[model samples]
Target chain A: MNGLKNDGISEIIDGKRVIVKKPELLAPAGTLEKLKIAVRYGADAVYIGGQEYGLRSNAGNFTFEEMKEGVAFAKEYGAKVYVTTNIFAHNENIDGLEDYLRGVGEAGVTGIIVADPLIIETCRRVAPNVEVHLSTQQSLSNWRAVKYWKDEGLDRVVLARETTGEEMRLMKEKVDIEIETFIHGAMCIAYSGRCVLSNHMTARDSNRGGCCQSCRWDYNLVEMEDGAEVAITQEGDSPFAMSPKDLRLLQSIPGLIELGIDSLKIEGRMKSIHYVATVVGVYRKVIDAYCADPENFTIQDEWLEELEKCANRPAAPAFFAGTPGADEQLFGVHGKKASHDFTGLVVDYDKATQMVTLQQRNFFRPGDTVEFFGPNLDTFNQIIGTVVDEDGNELDAARHPLQIVRFKVERPVSKDDMMRKGL
Target chain B: MNKPELLVTPGSVNEIKKQIEAGADAFLIGEQRYGLRLAGEFNRQQVKEAVALAHEHGKKIYVAVNAIFHNEIANELDDYVAFVKGAGADAIVFGDPAVVMAVRETAPGFPLHWSPETIATNYYTANYWGKRGAVRAVLARELSMDAVIETKEQADVQIEVQVHGMTCMFQSKRPLLGHYFEYMGKSMEIQKRQGTQNMLLHDAERSNKYPIYEDANGTHIMSPNDMCIIDELQDLVEAGIDSFKIDGVLQTEEYRIETTKLYRKAIDLCVDQPDQYEEEKEGMLEAAEALQQEHRPLDSGFFFKETVY
Candidate 1:
């Protein structure tokens, strides 16, 4: 049995029975640093956007040169990279269509993620050899739409997030194409990628990647003649009209794998490296464990606990369970942030003095109990004692950013353990 | 003398008959509070019934199927398309391509007209749909009169220009503050009930404010200015426009009768006194202005080659 063996279906790659990895740990990389962190923490692949065309305009996206570097870096680490160019192009902007496709093709990226039919047709004409993955913005609901794209030479379809596993399974049965879905991320109030509300209301087109998110604002009902204010539904207070809660499917990996999903996409291109690493690491461990023993394996409470640390808004399975009502407001109150601060992880530990050297992010004084979150462990709290700077001077707190400080510990610690304060 | 087509929006059969008697050439039945009060009022069966009644009075009936459809409703729309086809609608107006194709496939013989929401801006788009079974295309509100003439020359489809009505300021599919306001407690119906004279301020920072009402009684303040094109009849005829569309589907019967009668007389005068048509322009403008004072502000639309100042 090879390292890949985990499920019923095993393949012999180079004379070894390899267990096929069901779903890949796809992470979001907004920057090169997050890209590196995602790979180091056991991500199978990463999805990113270039400077201009992706859906997430706010994410600190990479330039052409940076994308090339990022792609090379992911490749070196034996991981794949997907680039987004999913914007609706106007007639004036169609002139540069060929150049952009050819540029990305020459860059040697894995595939071009697209939304518009015009772009798809243009890409087919310009770079026929490049793999084209249909974006979720197309609102691919039925098998007819899926079959239409598949017949048009699309390699994969990012199934609309509004679909359930049963629907996905049905779609997979109908077509012989790869299916990708958002396993985790922020949900849109409008139909997947089809919202013109922002543009209509605020002149900022969400499809064009310039959404002002006027839907998330608070509103009060007023009477016409007197302009008498009637009801006020503040953010997070109104059940019928709140932002959709975030989607979390960590526990449902087995069912998703059974449904034959080609990729498990994580949704957050604008997240921190710690978030990327933590999410990737948790899913990686979960999938590995499931593949090892699908029948006997059970999800630990710790994995769910680790997922909560990465910022969530009352996690729900989303449309996979059933259609979410108007009341499942995903956007929370304005001031809510995770109570804990993630400083940094322990890169290397010294063996001689039984002391652990820390790569610090924020200041921590003795007696401050911080949680140690690692790839396998859920999260375990430990109290700080006998802290010293790298120069061997005793310090009350390590205040400097990225400052390496040493502290004595009673228990053994590994490189994977992440230290966070004020949990 | 030939009378211009009087298009009246009547909610009930009685209202429809009254408008017909009052000189309405066509009856547009839609569900606005006091108008056609039923939801989905212009479905397949209702359209057949409405058309039968309009044909009794030697008038035409056009149905409005211009709402945007999400994915789940596409199949339900297929049934509606089939219904419209069997009912023999004079023209099925639509905005979505999927709906257009469905209507064409279901009823290839039926006339399909492009709704204003489709944003038919140039000759290419107009011709594109014309080739694909669209019998007529409604001009976008932003187009100038000369542009419409140029488009008409290139188009294979019949051109229908809005003569008068409340013009939609935003594009058809864009999100509306109304959705936000409705989700909140504010009633859009209240402003509609109070009439346009009663000022309703939405917010201090809001650039535009339309009246809203409590329940369904408030007056809808988004009404566009009435269009009076009696003076421009000669220019429009010379421009080769096949149809002049009146925008009100839910206005008063008296307003509909008066405007339609005025334009009808003007259309006839253009044929008899071709040279004298230019001299009658002032009288047409005066009539249109008179109607505007009693209703709302009016614009010349894209009938003139340039923006009418």
Candidate 2:
């Protein structure tokens, strides 16, 4: 059992009977509903933030009041909540820093996530007891940077996304500190989070949490002859180009665990509940399976199939396995299409009657092929054969959006089962 | 009349000696194509050696340490500062405040000059650093002569203006192309091909066409207009600026000697006949035109605030 004793559960490791505390299955939640879904699906921790200061402003982030409710709700489920206030503050904006810090602290949040040194200093001075997780935005690529933050009283350093397992191991060996790495997510074209390109191009600093992703814009090539201008559009596109692949590191879980990385992070803060539930569930299963038998553990193909159903660019191992090249680059074309269109999920599945009822989001018709994604199950896809409406009459399709509907599922489904169409 | 400072960007040691023999006041050692290049093998110690050589010939030398430093190199700041200070160089030109503070703490007595990238738009920020410990502030290339005078009043330190060479239209805070190479898993050697081979897109086009290999993001041309303030020496001196800076970090010894001699002669005329300075303007323009012919279509730049965009 490789699990920590404080948490529940036991598993065998290294041919010895050891208690394996379930590793915290942290998930990204972009909305209130997604937060609830993540909690219900067994997320040990959820990281989120208010719209203004957090790194991903484009995501459906919570407001201050909503964040307060999020914290309270997570506490009820016995899970931790971390709020981001990680924008780089200039001298002028430092005035509001105290209020923001006080607000989050008073709200009973777990910790404050920050990147800038001045903000770190301010947080330490004002809310000394509040835990501070150093954001990856500071680009902690080297051990010296980590040591500096650790000396400054930082609780944990979210290592730069570009760091490899070997690098993480070396860092862990060098310092006695809590290290976190992004196990899954969108990889930045810039070094981890040191990008000022968007800010320079459009006054939307990624460091300040307002990133107008100018890197994603298209550009046309221009040729010159003898200093005389020659417009060349051989590629028939803007000379500006961008890579649009999402990072996936599912196979490297054992490697990460061996590296002694404290936490694994998932990148999307603007994805649906089904996407969150399916991904988290798949990872949770893989982690459990690995702990059961590290040497013989294998990632099931069905989990990879479920992952492919989610909306993503092409999946690549990123800089972890080795440095990526042009072959990995996603040019003008968008990658894979999402197989299932997300409707509301099954909040509760009745076991005895083989009936799975869903809190309908978008309208689902009888002929539409739907897939049920739940924890510990390979996402089962089936065409909607018989739909029982509110009137108990079998209908070809259920048209009303967000309406509750019942359908028969072949497998035994549990509570918090996510349902989607098109799979 | 004081001999005008001869700013030369020598590619080799022989060129440095040649410029010294041609009555140059100072040797400004920088990479030829790029505005300033002191990375890897070419570092502060090498710059110190160049400075030492210039000092041997009774010439002052200014080292350009103006590149943006990533956080990874923060620890190296103190060592580099100590080396420059210990070498007894005239001044260390810097852009980042982290570098500035590191230098101030490491070598408290050394003179630190603000690189133009500091964006000293007004006296507030200028005086902020000047009060801290800077000896000189390089005014932004885009500033009008009038704005320079305005800033001159509030500045506690000596003001240096770019009297010649390329003018950057955008701030140096733009993301470096070198970073683009890192992201794509390519070598920064790609920069030498694109950067040196052609004038950057933003720069004025010359007849020398070369292939512009786009970085992961895109390609940008160099600054089009080379600044010429030779005819305005009297107005500049009257405006109370202490030093005139030339931007070429890459120029032939002949170019440096001729330009320096002409400017030195103009400055003498201005001192000899301050009231009749207009009489010498034609001769100065002729000399400036001769240099401009070698590098055509010189821009007066933001000195008089002509339409740029």
Each candidate's TM vs. the true structure? 0.68, 0.68
Q: lDDT (0-100) at residue A398 of candidate 1?
A: 77
> How do the residues B113-217 of candidate 1 rate in per-residue lDDT, one tens digit apiece?
776331345565566567656788877654556667777777788877767654443221212233334444455642433322333223324433332222221
Give the root-mean-square deviation of each candidate in angstroms.
Answer: 8.4, 8.2
What interface RMSD does every candidate have?
7.9, 8.7
The lDDT per prediction is 0.63, 0.62
Candidate 2 residue-wise lDDT, B36-76, digit = tens? 33211234555667777788988776665554433435457
Off by over 4 Å in 1: A1-21, A200-202, A223-241, A330-332, A345-360, A372-396, A400-418, B1-40, B49-81, B88-309
- TM-score of chain A, model 1? 0.85
Give candidate 2 regions above 4 Å deviation: A1-14, A17-25, A192-194, A200-203, A223-225, A230-240, A348-356, A376-378, A386-396, A399-401, A410-415, B1-45, B53-309
Write the residue-wise lDDT of candidate 2 on A43-104 in tens digits. 77788876556778677878778888888889898987887777655333456777877777
